[model samples]
Target: MTRLAGMMAKSAVAPLDRLKILMQSNCPHYSRFNLWSCYRAVLNKEGFLSFYKGNGAAMIRVFPYAAIQYTAYELFRPLMRALMGPHSHIGNFTAGAAAGTVAVTSTYPLDIVRTRLAFQVKGEHVYYGIMNALQKMFHENGWRAYYKGYAATVAGILPYSGSSFYFFDLSKRIMLKYFPKQTTTVNEEKGGRLELSIWAKLICGCLSGVIAQTAAYPVDVIRRRMQLIGMHPAYDHYNTAMWRVGVIVYHEEGMSAFYRGLSLNYVRAIPMVGISFTAFEFFKQLLRIEEHAPTS
Candidate 1:
């Protein structure tokens, strides 16, 4: 159910997702493009379907990613709460970071494939399909290539996932505090839990996404840049170290390099997180899962 919800939410923002990747990539050809210009370029060059270039890989990758993320969160949350107590935000943050790390480690290769596919021009296809992309990456650099930037990704996701879940849980509590009537009580066999209204869930998700994405975006940019090493012509000589990539981006493009696609990310993230949390919560309700806890 979490996987389905993730796929649906991702599909809703597929075009923007592609755009965000393109904007974030270290490819020199796309350096001048913004969201609208990139959209126009894709449309004119590859037609409408171009917007979904890597969505197949995205869906395939996201299923496991989301499944592991949510599952790990659930498993870790109770442990964290037991360790840090129920009201501590550190529990939520730690759980989220652990969940993100586990999920990313399990599914990092597919992300490289997705980015490679998305970065391709319409007729200038570097990879014909997912399998071909995998084959090419393997043949080019062996298994290590798949795990390129992996440490950076884990590092980035620590803050991204930690802050996202932390803020979401925090915001939900605030909303429930201010609008107590909007909260619904769920009677579980063990204990009762409060569920926020759909609107509150959406609001919490969006705000959390924005804050988290903004905070961790520079690391994300560095991760993307490192992932493109050996893949993008501009980064052909680049190493996979996070600090090295950060240095290069800063030296060549200045500070703004770290925030390349942040605006597009914000645009995509709000709706993406909103839909993801709302769908997950809705599904939990439908399936009668415990809802009082933070299930982000």
Candidate 2:
């Protein structure tokens, strides 16, 4: 059910994700194009399915990514809470970061395939499909190619996931304090665990998405840039050294360059997180799924 919720959220936001990747990696075809123009270009050129170009690879990565992330958070939060106090935001953040790291490490190579697949321009393709993309990278670029942006991804996930689950747990605490009635009774079996109402979950998710995305976005761009190395001519010379890429982006396009696709990302992320959290909560509540106690 957690995986299902994550899939529901990821599928809905895929197009925006594609566009964000295109813009962030500075896809030459869509260079200097605004959001609408890029959408039109994708629609006109490759039909609707092109909007979900790498969605298959995304699914492959996201299943384990989301499952492990949420599950690990559940497992780690208790440990963190044991170490920190019940109200420690630092505990929540650490659990989230640990979860994100575990998930990313397990599924990162598939992420490279996803980005490379997204880089393909239907007619002029670098990779034709998911399997082909994996095979091509393995054959041509070798094992090291699979982890091009790993360092950046690891660095970025800390804050992104940290804030994400922190806000989630924090919101639960805040809501329980201010709107005690807003929490559901679904977690009674989990030793009086507090579960937020579905609406509360959705709202919490949106706020979390906005803050988390904003915080980690520039690092995301760096990771995307690193992943695109050799996928496009423009990115062929892009540095794999994460810091070097950050420096180059600054030199070439100034600080604003780091946040090129951020607006579109927010457009995608807001609802993405909202739906994901809501779905997870709704399903968990509906099925009476038992999870760890919510931090105080």
Candidate 3:
């Protein structure tokens, strides 16, 4: 269900995701245009299907990524509770961070392939397909190439995942406290677990995503540059050291470079997180998944 939700949400925003990556990676062509102009340019040059260039890889990566993160979160929750008794918020943040770290680390190779595939333009291309990309990367740069931006990814994901789960849980508590009617109980007699209304859940989920994305957007930009540094001349100069990448972008492009493509990120993230959070819960209840769990 979590995988399904991620796929549905991610597929819906693939175009925006690609556009953001283009700008974030400082692609010579697409980065030169504004949002509307970039969209039109891609459509005119590469056709509509170009928007989904790497979506196949994304879907493949996201399925296992979502499954691992959500499952790890659930499995780790009880351990966190035991470790951090009376500090539920802290537990939630740590559990989410751990889950995110595990998921990203596991699926990182595919992430590299997905970025390389998406970073390619119509005429100027490095990789033709998923298998080609994987083969070329390994043959040219060896296995370590797949984890080029691993440090940046983990650095960004810590705060992103921590705040994401924390804020969602916080929002639900607020809703139950002030907007009491907006939530209900599944096993009121036994579990006493509160299930938020769909609308309330969506609001919390979207808001949490926006907050988490903002907090981690800069590292995300760095990660994109690192991931695609060898793919094109535009980003290739940044292929020195990971810290040097940050220093160069800051010194040359100014602080704004760290936030490149952030506006489009918010536009893409809201619906994606909303759907993932809301749809996951809906399916969980429908399938009676994790019914033994204390909360949704």
Tens digits of lDDT, candidate 3, 1-296: 56776887788899998888888887778767877898899999999999998899999998888889888987887799899973578998998899899999999999988888888899898898899998888887898888989999999999999899789777877777777664655456446666666888899899999999999999988999999867776777877777888998999878998888899999999888887777766776666673332332
lDDT of each: 0.82, 0.82, 0.84
Residue range 1-296, candidate 1, lDDT tens digits: 66777788788888988887777775565678776887887788788888888799889988788879988998998899999998888998999999989999999999988888888886678799999999989998999889878878888999999998899888876766666666544446436556677887898899999999998898887777777777767777568467877888789889987887788888889988888877777787777774464443
For all predicted structures, in order, the TM-scores are 0.91, 0.90, 0.91
Which candidate, 2 or 3, would have the higher lDDT against the true structure? Answer: 3
> Which residue pairs clash within candidate 3?
none
Q: Count clashing residue pairs in model 1.
A: 0
- The 10-residue segment of model 3 with minimum total lDDT is 287-296
Per-prediction backbone clash count: 0, 0, 0
| Cα-lDDT of candidate 3 | 0.84
Candidate 1: regions farther than 4 A off = 182-194, 291-296
Mark the regions of model 2 whose C-alpha exceeds 4 Å error after superposition: 181-195, 283-296
TM-score, candidate number 1: 0.91
lDDT of 2 by residue, 45-81 (tens): 8788887888888887777777788889889988998
Residue 279, model 1, lDDT: 76
The lDDT leader among the candidates is 3
* Candidate 2 whole-model C-alpha lDDT, 0 to 1: 0.82
